[model samples]
Target: MAALPRQQHPDLLVGLETADDAGVYRLTPEIALIQTVDFFTPIVNDPYLFGQIAAANALSDVYAMGGKPLTAMNILCVSLKMVAKETLQAILTGGMDKIHEAGALLVGGHSVEDPELKYGLSVTGIVHPDRVLANSGARMGDALILTKPLGTGILATASKGRLATPEMEAGMAEVMRTLNRIPEDILIAGHIHAATDITGFGFFGHALEMARGSQVTMTLFASRIPILAAAREFALMGLIPAGSFANRRFCERHLQTAPGIDPLILDLLSDAQTNGGLLLAAAPQAAQGIVTRFQEEGCPAAALVGEITAPGKGIIRVEA
Candidate 1:
């Protein structure tokens, strides 16, 4: 908050210190430009799917602000010696396909030689100034809804199992490889208020981000929070990813566990995600409608997990 030009600009909705998705620059009294960029190593072994997920993740920051992704430029870091040039081509092609799907054009790109392949996009998007959703817009009574299921971390770990089953791989791949576009669509359609995509931070870390950003306390029902079927097995198999530890370190201060809570279930809440979905804060009337909207869009797992309270200074509690 201290780093931004908030003193000079009044319309900067959210920036470096607020934990918001993108930095919004007001173009006019009624229009704003949203900008965000991201790139990460492939979360999965499939180069093409990795490209697609990377593009989606990068674009998600814009959508998290209820903005439309209008354009992007590819960002690549490739190892010319280790991986074949063809793999990089397929990777870029996959990213291009997703950008095209979102009606965003890739005008150009830059590449660098490295030891490993890294790909994503630098996305630019547009939104009406008044309609821009900031993480702080969440009200005390706003309902909390998660647009996707948790467990990508555990599942991905399970995928590395020596006896990894085809079914398990299929499940984890679909979750990690998919985009958060639908939740963005719903938010843009005015079905939600504040929105944020859950990615590397995992579900609880992101929840803490929103709670702290909004200066509100959030109470979530453990039973209602959705999880993948394979997460438990993965945890039992000790397949948790490294990011899980980071998430816990950063977010542990705000979380409050309930009695008899399964430790693995707790871990799932901290597991890192790839192309995760949006967590929306909306009014109750709009909350049910939002769930229905996701379901109609074929997202049955979408759930209203909790609600916000008066600003509790920071993340308040995470209980069953």
Candidate 2:
């Protein structure tokens, strides 16, 4: 963004300015390729589970933008001397299963030897230019909706060294492995104005980006935020992760905190989500319908977390 060097092609429509879910390069006035690639090291210990989480996280970008994933190429970095082939196979199997579940074809994939294990997908999805969802269109009075409970990052951190409890691990794993497909159908049906998937950036970080990108402010109600019960209980026990701190730092300037609510709640909001759900800004009337639709689609964690407000006041306000 510093300077669009000379050879850069000018885009007639929106693309990178909004910190969108994915990069849209228009092929024509009618169609655009929504491309996104996200890869990371194992978040969980089980190779198979790690792969599933990674695949779900990677494909979420396309879904967030109201695009259906059509095809994908597997990306793998394996440590040949460091791990057994069986472990790698489990990882691949996990990813393949998720890709199939998403209705996206895993036509081919690439694997290379490396010092650390990494796996994800480089996905391509198709969408009509006119039907694409964007983050810049969020309006005042729009109710903010979150489709998944927060705090996956906290559990994952505790999951390391067997520090995580059975209930805690089960809850985070369940949410992280769950796909955000429920919201995609909602987006395609039209009415959703702005949307973004939560990942390493945490909810507040991404919400701030949407607000700043749209030149608006978001007022979040802490009491109503749908967070896994374990997230709060464990957070008080100092089960916070390194990424949580990073997330807090990233959104600290744009966030407004209140007392009586333990500071641990911020840790929950800033918790680095792996394959977190969608945070949508849409008309107030649509909020209840969207939440209900998500419940019908098996995402009971979805809820109306807050509302978008006017600009210059603040990007986010976390109630007491």
Query: Which one is best on TM-score?
Result: 2
Model 2 off-target regions past 4 Å?
Answer: 1-14, 182-185
Model 2, residue 100: C-alpha shift (Å): 1.1
Give one digit per residue, the lDDT tens place, for model 2 in 84-196: 98998898899889999989889898889899889999999877787777767788899999999998877776677577777777778778878788556666667788888
Estimate every model's Cα lDDT from 0 to 1: 0.80, 0.82
The candidate 2 region of ten consecutive residues with least summed lDDT is 5-14
User: What pairs collide in candidate 2?
Assistant: none
Superposed by TM-score, candidate 2 places the C-alpha of residue 209 at a distance from the truth, in angstroms, of 0.3
Pairs of colliding residues, candidate 1: none
**Cα RMSD, model 1:** 2.4
